[model samples]
Target chain A: MLPKKVKKRASLLTIFLLLSVIGVFLILNALNKNILYFNSPTDIKISQDINYNKKMRVGGMVKKNTLNINDQEIRFIITDFKNEVEVSFKGTIPNLFAEGKGVVAEGKLQDKKFFIAERILAKHDENYMPPELKNIMKENAE
Target chain B: MLNYFYNSNIFTWIEKLTNFINSIFFALLIAGLSFALVFSPPDYLQGDSVRIMYVHVPAAWISLASFSCIALLSIFNFIFKIKHLTLITKSIAPIGLMFTCIAIVTGSIWGRPTWGTFWAWDARISSMLILALFYLAFIFIHKLVSDEDRANKISSIVAAFGLINIPIIKYSVEWWSTLHQPASIKITGSSSIHSSMLMPLLLMFFVLIMYCALIFLMKYKTEIIRIKKKNLKRL
Candidate 1:
């Protein structure tokens, strides 16, 4: 049996910490949209209050075979499997931006179907390996 | 029981521990650096740019871990009313702030090559900036407040509130989409990071932990000395 003072403080801290953790989750749950940094194409399509002229971000995989590039601009379609947004950007994109890879386009929604991107940022998945190991893994999958 | 915390007793032990740590620190740092810079292979996709993870990841870990330590000590001090606990927390704050800054800087440097921008006001990045702000508030509370008791009380509450942000930072990637990638390392379940890269990352993390330990011990020793000097003046 421990002293009451030790026990009291321990219990108090535990309660305080639990409340803080639970409180955060509740607050985050309520303020989910505020905290979410970017919206997927599906989010844009579903949300009712979306402002077309207001600049926003739409992140999703660069749809395969939809990329159409020219000297002045690059056009591609981003998809979340459920929905898709066509994005057109004039600026240079990141090296990692590729078809069938994660990409986040920042700009204005031209309409429900088209987005004018001011900038394109590449998003990578969690996997990390050397080129040789990545090649071996790819070979195994094939 | 109180005698265990006698300043002179703790002070003497601090000296020996600091010296022992100093002797081994350089060797470990050299090994860690060599493995991080030379031995580690380039990323399959990211190539050599991924090497920045050696400093960036460890600093991020240290900053987060240090905040948790400070918050725990603060709670113990408030409950147990232990002056020794306050010393420990106070010693930890600056180190936490330093590493928090390091993590942000190194992360941004790593960002340019990958994210195309040095900074973005995304959830993960913004929350981390808020964390650095919390550290500043914790340190400034102690420095600016004249009454030691009041300072401790205020700082303890501040740390408790700051504790809420820890979970936010950790889950930010998962809770929301951001420019930052999801964590590759995990405490439970399988990690996505390869063993070859993991080795150097762990080595660098160990070296930074040792560095933090050295700084904490030295700062703690000084706090004890300051208390003793104050006591002698009262006589």
Candidate 2:
């Protein structure tokens, strides 16, 4: 059996190791709070005030029939299916960026609910479409 | 007996101090998000799409470093027959995998604004995807083997083999047609990024590196503790 002193030393080492890890974490946190994740649009709307100049990503689906294209400026509404945010972009649309699709727009908020997008992204699932879409086509023919 | 009490008190104090300070990962996560959110200067050309670089670059760096650790640990285990080395490597798999996922997701998000598409099977993207797959394979093999010794040997071999792809991934942009931009920060040459933007980017990278190191150390320490306990219990 190991001596009591040896056991004590081992325990102390473990404590020291753990403390060192936590110490590093705290030092970094004190320097800058970079780890805190942002909330979705719904959450952002409910909580603290957002600055007009500050940039953030607001995620949601495009509301049906809200997109209006006027030469350079393209405007649309993003809905969490509960609350909607108006998003305007002054650039060419992303290739996958279609109306009535899920999008996450990055930009600053202007007037409440108005987001002037610096960038717009389209999100899609990784998996391929099942045979169900084809099966539906066959059923429609029958 | 007196020495024991004194030592115990020291240990307790250390624990309290660590708890009070908070985790490095938490700090880094906050610093990274905030710096990226506000202070980082916009790109001269891409504008705000430049902001995505804060998250994308750090995540990619972490993924790369973690894989390097895996390769090193695998080699160590293979050469020295260290029992805990493989476990440490295995513990890092999830962290590496998560970093890779973050890199891919953030890269795709950045790509949409700049490249006009969420994805392209460009050289860099394809290589990152393959790296992620290699990590997945590591996780799968670790799960497959029942015998500890055999598992360690096989997984170490697999990890060593996976190292071959890291260079290909790094140089893919130069070797293939890619929408992904070539390296902005280069060795043997000055960085393409301007000084105004580079400072915060470097700061953010440092923060990310610290966080990754802290987490890896924590995970590795925990794995060692758990394995020791299991060995003790078995004996």
Candidate 3:
């Protein structure tokens, strides 16, 4: 077995490491609700802690057939399959924002059902493929 | 023992290694760039902009890996009083900071077309920014602190503290809904990225690792020289 000094130091180091890990875990845990960058439609719909008056973020897919575009104002419904939040924004949307694509919008919650987005950001999944392969997958899906 | 530990033999080795890396670095860089910019197919969605991943992903990865390495070494050195490891940590800190900055900038550039914002205070982005600050703190403490022993001790503790942020950065996407996309590549599970893109990305990562090696060797050699100079009058 190791000497007493080495063992003590080892235990000391272990304690410090454990404490640091636990401390960080607690800190991140406490900040979990605050550090969340955006909320899904379901989160906004369900979470009672959310302040409706404060500016916040809601993110999800641009629901199919919900995209209604006119001059200066674009209206769409963002959904995460469980709940939907209607978004109205007057800004230049990203090139990738399309119906049934992921999107993140920042605004104040007017109510649970409608959101006015000051800034709209597109979101994409991790998958990357060539257009031909993508088309084949789309065809297969259809 | 001190003299032997910092002997000239390692200097010769460093020189040769630097020369060897210099010889092959350009060829590998060219190949990696060509693969990244030309050979790899554009994403079905992002098109040519996806090329940014070749640099951004690798740089971000190296920065994370470097910080972890330094933190581990620093912990050991703080415990064991290993002088050589301190040298190694010092050499690595600048490189880590550089790559962290590169990753942040490249990621910002990639965000415009895809995410529609140059910057956001999202969990992932904010956490990475915190990482850069940690790197800065680790590096600047070394440069600004007057007492070497104190500097090393404080910096080691700082690095140990920053170690916690590593996982936070890694899991920020899944833990919190963020604008940043989740990782496409996984160490254990099957990667979502296709082989074509992955090849260039790995190639670029290899080349950048080589570049980091070159920089690290030079910095280590300089530190060795600086130490030897301090002892020159005695000799």
Task: Say which prediction, candidate 1 or candidate 2, comes out ahead on lDDT.
Answer: 1
Model 3, residue B184: displacement in angstroms?
0.6
Considering only chain B, what TM-score does candidate 3 achieve? Answer: 0.96
Query: What DockQ do you compute for every candidate structure?
Result: 0.64, 0.03, 0.76
lDDT of 3 by residue, B1-235 (tens): 6556466598787888899999999999999999999999999999889999999999999999999999999888777777888899999999999999999999999999999989988888888898899999998999999899999989998998888889989988888888899999988999999898999999999999999999899899899888889899689
Q: Arrange candidates by DockQ, highest first: which order?
A: 3, 1, 2
- Kindly indicate the candidate among 2 and 3 with the higher DockQ: 3
- Candidate 2 lDDT over A1-142, as tens digits, reads 8667556645654464466556744753573322222235676678576677887667667888898999879999988787788989987666556666667677888866888898776643211212344357569999
**Cα lDDT over the full model 3:** 0.90
lDDT of 1 at B225: 79
TM-score of chain A of 1: 0.89
- Fnat for every candidate: 0.72, 0.04, 0.82
Largest DockQ belongs to which candidate?
3
TM (chain A) per model: 0.89, 0.65, 0.93
TM-score for chain B of all predictions: 0.97, 0.85, 0.96
TM per model? 0.94, 0.57, 0.95
Clash pairs (backbone) in predicted model 1:
none
